[model samples]
Target: MNAQAFPPIPFLDLKAQQARLPGLKARLDAVLAHGQYILGPEVHELEAKLAGFCGAAHCVSVSSGTDALQIALMAEGIGRGDAVFLPAFTYTATAEVPLLLGATPVFVDVDPRTFQMDLASLEARIATVKKAGALRPRAIIGVDLFGQPADWAGIATIAAREGLFTLDDCAQSFGAAQGGVRLGKAADATATSFFPSKPLGAYGDGGALFTQSAERAALYRSLRTHGEGTTRYEVLRTGMNGRLDTMQAAVLLAKLEVFEAELARREEIARIYDAALKDVLAVPARMPGSQSAWAVYCVTLPDEATREAAKAALAAASIGHAVYYPRALHQQPAYQPSHDGAALPVAESLGARVLALPIHPDLSDEQAQRVAATLIQALGG
Candidate 1:
């Protein structure tokens, strides 16, 4: 095939996704007519729907994914002198929340292949921290990296035994599940993002926290709005402004109609990539009893050099690709000081080898095959 005959395949085609926007526009128009943009009726409706979808008793909408994490941590009373266990392979927001609340973020390594938190590494880190007598182990922020759910059952058992709270960072795994249990049900509290590219996304920044405990849910609701117990004017505790916009809720409601269909499409696309690339590259593993939302189809090259060469080849071929986390969180400038010289070999290694291929629910079958073929050729398969 001639290079000129094929145009570049975007990393994420938001314009292709826009074909699903008409229904959302109608919902937005209705929301505008009602003129309750703050926390309108649609917000409550969306919260109820999301709570039911995730098998949680309550869902509290927040302004952004980061806000959801902060509110959940605050509701659990994690503060100064507390330490939150998290995987260093994840996005900065996972650790930033703990730091913002005056708590410490203890970095742990991830599974080299799965790219999820390594449970053994987590235990080791916990033991190291406890032995030091420097901080209290307050919570474990289990991130569902690359849209795959973490080892929640294993993590939950460990948290229960250790007497620590658990929060599922479902920002990238909202629709994911394991052993018939959804992401929200796997942890003490689950926070999910509605960023435009997430499986169940809104038009703009939006997020929600889910929990089974009504008391905890109530506290989160209050904490999201300046910690108001009775009214907005009466403050019971310190809180930040973290309410999700009603317009976003309206858009999300419309998108929810076809969320399952989109998820199915994403799974199909991932399977296609796997079938085409598995022989030549290290494909993502779907652990037994787990279902990923397929937010990204990431593959690992033989080494850093091969990864770089593959990326350049794809670019020259007009095929888009990206490196999700070129640098592990522990190696990042802001987090390096807190790591106390602890090393995360797996995360550091995978940071150099992992590459995210063009993937999205709206990605075309032809485009996916072309991407896989291009990657295979680039990798000299």
Candidate 2:
């Protein structure tokens, strides 16, 4: 079938998802009816559901994923000269939160195939940081980039050996799994986003933290609510106004009713894309013993020029496409002064070759086929 015969493709069809969710309006209306806008019953309900969904002992909902990261670090007393190791090839938020807290982010190179944090590079960076004596290796923020689980087993071993805290940046990979277990409890603390575009999104900015330790859970709760020990007037420690809104919690509850099915549908779409593009393009590699949330289905083009040409061609065909990250964290102008002039070869080189395609659950087989065929045609197949 000709790609031109298919309907217009959207990079993310939130409207289609909304259409599937019949109870969404009612959920939102309930929030409006109730006067309590902040940390209402819905918020607690959503937290419990989320925790149970991932088998986490507790869930601390927050205003956003960035705040979740900051609160987690704050709970650990990570500040000034503390090194928060993370991948260079991910969204800026992963690195930004560390700098916001006055902690230096040590950029680690990523795997060429998986686009995950390279364990070897992470260990080497930790060693270098210790040798320099300028910074203390406090934590490792292992990111589940592009919805696939990072090598948590390896990260755990390293963190244990080095006496570092493990923070799972599951901002894009909440529904992802490893070794048959879900992501929320993979690290000492896991933070996930509910940005409108994430795999499991809220109507607005929202996030949560997962932990097994009762003390950590209590600390997170207090940190998120202005450090109130027992009463709102009694301040125990410095904190932020990082509470999840009741309305957003309501929206998530409705979405959660169908989340598992939606996740399965995303996998089905990914398989279609894999079968169609793997022969001609560098499709994403499936990591062993894990499942991706399928947040973004990216492909590697030959080079910068080829990527640009393909982007133009996709535009001409009315097919939705995008570039995940045009520059690595170390290369960004804002972080240049902070970067230690480390040569992250794979991360630096990746910006020239990667392109993202439409892979939302809303995509039908015909639309996915059109996307795949259009890309192949764009690449001069």
Candidate 3:
């Protein structure tokens, strides 16, 4: 069969989303007409809508997902000599934020199947930190890797016992739920992204912080705008310029109208892949009592060589595939010194073999089945 017979698949079909959002142009036009670009009405509107969507008391919009994490940490005064524990098998942003704030990130191993922070590893790493007596265990950043909620109950219990602050990195899992509740209130402070690829993405770079406390909400507001006391010019404390733009907020507002249906579609596609590909490879494991946003659908190949073979097959079939993180954060050159030779076997192994298939709301069932068949053929399974 000619490879051209199969249509080229997109890893993320933002254009299809744009086509669905008819109000997109109207929203942009309203932004232009109002001309209150910075911290405009749309920004406030978006913040309120986002907070309500996940039952959070407050949602402070920021420049990006990284900014959301930074603002949340800054509010807690997590600086030098502080230790921030997080999973090693995630995006670089999660680990890099702590180092940027003069804190050390203790990389913990993730669950081999679920791809979430391993609670056992987390407890052991905290003990290791205490034994070293060098850094203070101040915060634990539980990342909801790939759209599934982390073990927030376990993480919360650990944080309570150890006297550490908890931060939820919900960048890819904003719409996800745990224990019948949405993710915004799962941690002490929840940070999520609205990057163009996120489940609830904006047109451009954007993010928000969610918290149930009014005090923290107020602090986040002040911190995002140069830590102002009352007026914009009066700086009460040091803070970064991390305000979300009106245009992005307008775009998000439009997208939010269809966000629920999109999330449902993503889950349906994930199920289709699950049923079709389980026998061929290690499919993504569903978390108990949880509903994921299904931001990514990653499967494990038998080995690194098999992954390469699958990649070649996917390309030949005109299908899109990607590796979430080709290298664990601890294995990265910049973080090697901080890692200090700490072994994270699960993370290291996932780096070499895991592969992400094309998963988006616009992906059809036929396309999903095609993806599975191609991978199965490639792996000779």
Give the Cα lDDT of each candidate. 0.89, 0.93, 0.93
Best by TM-score: 3
Every model's TM-score: 0.98, 0.98, 0.99
Q: Candidate 1, which ten residues in sequence have the lowest lDDT sum?
A: 13-22
On residues 1-381, what C-alpha lDDT tens digit does candidate 1 reach at each position?
Answer: 455789878887777776876787788898889999999999999999998887888899999999999999998889999999999998899999999999999999999888999999999999999999999999999999888999998999999999999999999989888987777878989999999878887778999999989998889888989899888799999988999999999989988888888889999999999999888989999867988998878898878999998888888888878898998998999988888678789988888899999778877899899888877777777
Estimate candidate 1's alpha-carbon lDDT, on a 0 to 1 scale.
Answer: 0.89
lDDT (tens digit, per residue) of candidate 3 on 237-268: 99889999999999999999999999999999
* Residue pairs clashing, model 3: none
Counting only residues 3 or more apart in sequence or on different chains, how many pairs clash (N, Cα, C under 3 Å) in candidate 3?
0
Q: What TM-score does prediction 1 earn?
A: 0.98
Q: Lowest-scoring 10 consecutive residues by lDDT in candidate 3?
A: 1-10
Give the lDDT of residue 129 in candidate 1.
93
Report backbone clashes per prediction. 0, 0, 0
